[model samples]
Target: MGSINKTDLCWGDNYNLTEWYCNASNSIASKTYNCPYGCPYFAYACKKQNDVCVDSDGGKNWNVKGSITFANSTRTDHCSEISTGPVLVEYYCDDYGRIMEAYNTNCACNEGKCTDYFPICVDSDGGIDYFTGGQVTTSTSTIKDFCGNQLYNYTYESYCDDFGNANYKTYSCPNGPCSLVNGSGQCPSTTSTTGNVIYDLFKKVKIAGKVIQGIIS
Candidate 1:
């Protein structure tokens, strides 16, 4: 907003506002003037002196790289974030409690935030497909699994696929309807029915397998 000593209004970043002022002839008049600071912006620029600078997420959406955190301070200017390629926004408070913004090109705009180091490929779950709590991940090469709240009797998985793309999957316990798969409540064991008997093959330790050579040197 660029409304000075008037009741009219205008919108945009650093836009000129026309104001009705008294000239030397002492008559009501109109003259358009520009603000040296910034226009009241729903734009990135701060509009007025009392304008505040804040990050609702505390910069949580920005990627964390090279020990960098997206943050603002009450003290000196901070090279806070990036809007495009390598350009970064430096936010500062003028002596009058006015928030001003500047730009810095001398930055490593990794993942759209200023960082001391570049990003690295990462899997927060240590390459495991399924995880509890949150599946922490980072990188330009790695991605996170998409799923809703974990379902009961359901096993989730994440891993690379045959064609080399990442994959996330959910599976029901047991091949058929989920049954008590031992006590761990997971799937892996199979059950079969013989003539007049029904027995849990996995519990019997009667699985078919052959031991190979010892651990390699």
Candidate 2:
């Protein structure tokens, strides 16, 4: 069991719709459902017959209450079955079924397949970029000609959990501008100073441009 919030309170069973409800983990330490109102997150039914019940909103095996009669025929089940909102969250899972990254709808803006899987961004010049956790992990650059040789290469970087396991990153090279790629990879071989992430990406791009420009000149 997990934890319960104000949404989990209910006076009826699964069949009889009641107030919003959620469940916790088996240990019952904290409420796993942290979604706010109007946010598109997961939900479960609270089906305890007793007067007051705390439901498990995060764990599996949630029960949905059907038609119910309260005391006598004079009373009616006015509670309505709760419906989930639009898909606003995206999750990337590994082969072992573990979540790697999650993107919010407003941020990722990917519909349908992208709403559930990872996001892939390609620039006008065919440069690609991949990201998770609001950070770039992989990038591929546009193709370009240098010294009569078609230069092409890609850069790759990834994030690591506390246990030092690579999770997400990108890759790109020689072609032109870099683009993003999805999936886990080695930690970025390069490190930078503390700065806004976007700024850091711009700085790296500028440095790469300088190097390429010097070679081409």
Candidate 3:
């Protein structure tokens, strides 16, 4: 007969709940589980357990308690955040499967716990310049127009994030009359390029060559 394999602690990747078990690469990790309740006070997601005695924190909070009475109870097997730390009131099977024990377990890390997965709000405009996100307040980005308040029209440019999302930035105009053109802001320019304008103005005008040379010199 071959040697028998010993009982092993459960493990899985907590970042991705789709993974339910631990592999050679990912050993001794959390397993995905959904419980009927919530524990919403961890720096990481809340680790929840179903009515059964299964610790869904990918087994990170699981321990071996070889001597505990097996409690045949429902929803008793659960975990919750204790205060505002990395501790949990974890309830999980103690070796003997259905036999569970509660403890103030300390976890090195927290993942795939409290709070369901949902897409956050994103705004195309940077600010209230344009009514983009509407009444919704969760816009991670603001939908700002090229011009700000119509009363004081001015355009702005921002840096793009790694995901190609526009970052927030603001810029003011020359503090004079400005207008919006084709969604972009346009303002009167009082100054002209030095050399280019000088050539354009003097080249066409019929001025004495000597006078032009002297003026330029």
Full-model lDDT for every candidate: 0.39, 0.26, 0.34
Q: Which of the two, 1 or 3, has more TM-score?
A: 1
Error of 3 at 54 (Å): 34
Q: Can you rank all candidates by lDDT, best first?
A: 1, 3, 2
Off by over 4 Å in 1: 1-10, 13-16, 19-22, 25-113, 117-123, 131-134, 137-153, 157-169, 172-217
For candidate 1, the per-residue lDDT at 135 reads: 36
Clashes of each: 3, 52, 15
- Among all windows of 10 consecutive residues in model 2, the one with the lowest summed lDDT is 68-77
Candidate 3 structure quality by residue, lDDT tens digits, 107-217? 322331222222233433433332222221232644333444545433333334445445433333454433554554434444631111112111342244533421221
Query: Best candidate per lDDT, number?
Result: 1
- Alpha-carbon deviation at 115 in model 2, angstroms: 6.0
lDDT of 1 at 132: 29
Clashes of 2: 52
Off by over 4 Å in 3: 1-11, 14-144, 150-153, 158-163, 189-217
Q: Give the poorly placed runs of model 2, Cα more than 4 Å off.
A: 1-85, 89-103, 106-120, 128-217
Best model number under TM-score = 1
Better of 1 and 3 by lDDT: 1
